[model samples]
Target: MFLITDEQLDALLYDLATLYGYDFSGYSRPMLHRRFNRMFRLKEFSGFEDFRRAISNKPELLNWLVAEITVPVTEMFRDPEFFKVLREMVLPAVANAPLIRIWHAGCSTGEEAYSMAILLKELDLLHKSILYATDINPEVLKKAAAGVYPQNILEKYAENYYAAGGNQSFNDYYTSSYDLVKLNEQLKKKIVFSTHNLVTDASFNHFNLIICRNVIIYFNQQLQNRVLNLFDASLEQQGYLALGTKETLQFTSVNQQYQKPFPKEKIWQKI
Candidate 1:
């Protein structure tokens, strides 16, 4: 097994953060080590110092490294039951707001953003809502802004869409051609995709709802607390926060600051 000593890891992280501004310092050790190993194998680097030098010299290589580390794996209506809970329970609380701002933090490739837009449209609230989808990886953000997904995945997405309490035909949202499925232009209008790093970046705007699913699991407890505090600051009073099924505010610093709206669904409301 390839080994990266603590000194080597620290030096590499410092170099990468100083050069590229992508901080992996707060990520879990085991996960970061795995990513480092994979990158080392792919680049054929002799050691951590060599990899660091290569990354520092090539800015483009940093981008590729960010992509590899972030693991932008997402799907439309990824958790149908979660969406079902949102539709039936949480949505009604914010349905009457004149204007709404929904933040999808760590929204890898805009599937969740588009899924949210579809839900808002079905509820007749799309025109009044602004969805901000943010991720640290520019490559995925570019694809998300383009709103094109592989056509082959449509069948599975359709199943999820229907299961998530979709009001109408799932096919109505996109046009499939060749090997790509392009999301509807109207649906795209409501989404704003941008690059925002949760670790190093400050909160941009207050949001009525924040969905940062499956993201904080990669962070250590301190970083998780920091991010949870940031989310707390960004959320409006009584605003919603949705986390991954595996994640929880329990035992964290912000646990008392927010109460679970649906414990089973992992939805929390700011107190």
Candidate 2:
């Protein structure tokens, strides 16, 4: 029950970033404090200093922290109307292309990636689509790459699927066994899940569409701007960018660079 002072938290974060090169400085202070506090209690660390020492000495603990902090709380088609707009408007525009590269930023446990794959398959573009599902947490990326989800969640996802204009039965995309639903191999093959640090790493590839939903909300304005710039650079000319319904680039420096394709859904087209 040791209280973490502001100075202690700052020193701990700075030391970790310097030693590990994973920058969490841009994350919101309150959010970071809460996450760290939870981890502290769970691990039984006596104080912030103790947690810092463990993180420095045991690099694996840092990975655990990263997973705990960066993992998105998401579900398939969490925003159904967004996917509907994507299918009706964005898909048609990109469908004619010979190939498409999509980056699903902050894709946790692969729900959004699978959702995208299912949508592309319905549109007969799955074969030509390469989805890069990126998250900073390697643990989550491993799970996402495996494409297995809890069986209990499938019913809800199925409802989301139908609501988002699914063309076929959602059951067709997964096989249920025991408590798990293994995503179809066909859908898994189209997606490449990888670990990516939006705060510290440079953009690696240009994508036709970048769906970074709800990830930036925990980031400070400076970090959000940095990530947005990375996304801008990573996107091709006239590419599409989709954000969470509650997020927007309207007041940001990059606001003028993208036009609103569907303001309600928060889909923007690169200008």
Candidate 3:
């Protein structure tokens, strides 16, 4: 077990940003510490200095480090109630939109993006909708663009699909082959996957609906406020914003900028 002092931890974070341009200084210390320790152990580094040397020696390792720091574990139609609320309320508001633009921020592996595509297809709005699925990790963006997932998790995916008010058999959306399940091409065509860092990247386009679930908890309050401000800038007037159940804008300075449609759901509209 590698033990690190607070000063050393701060220095390490500085090195990551200075050397590799990967910043995690604004992240929650406990969460960052846990990930750092786990990475140190997994990489079998003698100490933080050794780990820093390794990163310096091999710049490619920064990719792995970034992945470790911004780890994302997500599923299709996660938090079923969230999607249920979207289908019942949000979808209807934008149903007649000539060009519906939905941004799935921090989309990991594209599960939820495809889930939204499926929902839109069912609602007969997919043909006019464009989904932008983005993440900080380019590696994950590649996987997300492929629209393939491990076959073993299909059961859970199907379960979540149904719970999120799926209209047809979930099996119809993907093809199973060997150990992989590739989502149908139609679903893939609807989404555009790209690399976007919520920490440092600026918003490129306005969106009608922005979904960023389960990604802000790792960030400190300051970083969270910055990100919420960015979201506020990116969303169109009266546009929708959905966050994870554990996340809320209530305590943030931008809380009044958004109005919650339902107390049970985290769905908010820019006001």
Candidate 4:
């Protein structure tokens, strides 16, 4: 395995920002080092210089490199209790929304967004809702937009679905062929998948709820604050914000501005 020195990592990060307009400098160095070293071996780079040059000289590789480095770790209906809260509490809180707008920030491959769609459809709010699922990596967004996933994971997702109060047959939501399944059209049409960088992108629109779970953990304090502020600005008054279970707003600038509805869950309402 090719190991990346601190200096080499710094230089590579600089080039990514300067040349490709991808700013990764605010990410935690230790996390970046781990991902970069792992990437080096996965891509079969002989040494630090080889890895650095491959990215610096060839811009097209940025998509895969970014996807690999960020590691879009997500699963359908992840953290069943959180989805249960969204179904039982959050969805009802916004039940009266005329045209529900939910932003799935850092929506890696979009299982959570599809999960939300199922929740909304179950509640008969799907017709008036729009879900914007976004991620920094376009490669992942493609899969999210496609609404396709491996068939083997369906069993796990089905367990989570019912745990989240699923009202219909879980199998009814998709069709399988050749070891993969595509989510039903009803779920796919409501979501608009696109590329968004939390590190630098500005808020594009206001939303009723912003679910950006488990994404900012890789960032340092400064970047975390910036992303939180962006989400704060993007949310409408009394809008909801949900983060990963292990993540919190307690130490951030916007902590005081939002009220945590459930003590156990990370869902918060803008006050």
Candidate 5:
């Protein structure tokens, strides 16, 4: 039960950015407080001073904190219908190109990005495509690069895959050993995993499709709009942008520049 006040929140964010180059200033204060308190309890810190001293003494603990704070609630094919839109409409729209580049922003643990790669392979577009999956967390990026996931979730993921309009045996995507499963090497080869913090990083390249799901909930409107603009600039003319089911482009500065082709799904096309 350590609780951080509004002042302490500002100081903590400042120190993280000024000293560590991690800018989380645009994140929601209440959300940050909740996550910070969770870390304090989980790490058994008595108070804010102790927590701060621990981080000062062992800078590496900051990485653990970042991982805990930014962890997204995700699963392979988490929203089946969204993936259905990508499979049926989005991917095909970009498949005609000789080379396709898709960006998966905040791609925690790489499930959805790999799901995209699997779909591209099934559609016979993998050879002409390259998937760029980026996240703010280096810890998750390492786990994602390895392509291993806990075996306990296999049944659920398989169900999601099937529900997302997957035609082949989902089992073909991975091999199980003990309590873990690793995605096929073929799928990993086409994906490039890297660390890209949305709050601080600029657009690296143009993309035919960008899948950034369930990531913006942490930000305030200003940061969300900044990110939407970055995505808009990085996307090719008429490229696709996919967000989490609850997320949207409406009411933002870039909302009018995009059109919702599949109204039911959260997929939009840049104008």
Candidate 6:
């Protein structure tokens, strides 16, 4: 196995950013190193230089690298309590609106977006809601738009749904076709999946609520603050912000601009 030196890693990140605009410079080095090393081994590269030459020869490899690096490990109703709070408390806060726009920032494979759709449908808000599910990976966005999942994962997701206060049979939301399950057409229609990089992209629309969970941990504090500020800007006054359980705004620049309504679940409201 070849060891990747710090200088080589820095050059790789710089080259990727400069040549393709896929910047990983703001990402945590240790995390990047781990992911880079994993890909290096998987690709059977002799060293960093070999990998760099390969990327130079086939530029599209950068897209695969981006997908691997930012690939999200997420599930439907990931933290059941988070979705529980969103249903029992958060949705009601915005339910009265004629048109409610919610942004699922860093949405991966459409699980959380579908979870939200289920919640909105149960609350009779689905028709009035327009959900935007964004991720940096176009491939993931394509899967999200399809709203399909492996059948093996549906059992776990069903449990999450029940725990998150699902009021109806979870099976009603999807139909199995061989090895995959497709989410309901109605629910799928409520969500629009698009590719948006939290690091480099500007906010395309204002939202009543923004849910960004478990995605920013790979970023350094500086990038986290930048993203938090972006969310703050993208949200309407007094709108809601939902983050992963481990994420916090207490130390970020936007900390004072939002208040925790469901602190345990990391749901904050803009002030």
lDDT agreement with native, every candidate? 0.89, 0.87, 0.88, 0.90, 0.89, 0.88
Model 5 lowest lDDT segment of ten: 65-74
Off by over 4 Å in 1: none
Candidate 1, residue 154: the lDDT equals 94
Clashes of each: 0, 0, 0, 0, 0, 0
lDDT of 5 by residue, 185-217 (tens): 999999999999999889999999999887897
Per residue, candidate 6 scores C-alpha lDDT tens digits across 45-107 of 866778998876775677678877887678888889888889999999998877899999989
Task: Provide the TM-score for each candidate, comma-separated.
Answer: 0.96, 0.93, 0.95, 0.95, 0.96, 0.95
Clashing pairs in 4: none
Off by over 4 Å in 5: none
Error of 1 at 162 (Å): 0.7
Candidate 3, residues 67-104: lDDT per residue as tens digits?
Answer: 77777789999888888888888988877767999999
Best by TM-score: 5
lDDT string for model 2 (1-271, tens) is 6667778779878987889777889999998888888888889976666788898898688878877778558888878888898888897888776789999999988899899988898888999999999888777888888888899988899899889988788888889899998989999998988888899889999889999998898899999999999999999888999988678997787999989867577889998
lDDT of each residue in 24-128, candidate 4, tens digit only: 999888999888887777788777777788887775667778976777889988999999998889988888989999999989899999999999999889999
Provide C-alpha RMSD values for all models, in order: 1.4, 1.7, 1.4, 1.5, 1.3, 1.4
Cα lDDT for residue 82, candidate 5: 87
Q: Which regions of candidate 2 fall more than 4 Å away from where they truly are?
A: 58-60
TM-score of 2: 0.93
* Quality of model 2 by C-alpha lDDT: 0.87
Q: Model 3, stretches more than 4 Å misplaced?
A: 59-61
- Indicate which candidate wins on lDDT: 4
C-alpha lDDT of residue 186 in model 5 = 98
Assess candidate 1 and give its TM-score to the true structure. 0.96
Total backbone collisions, model 2 = 0
lDDT of 4: 0.90
Model 6 local distance difference test score? 0.88
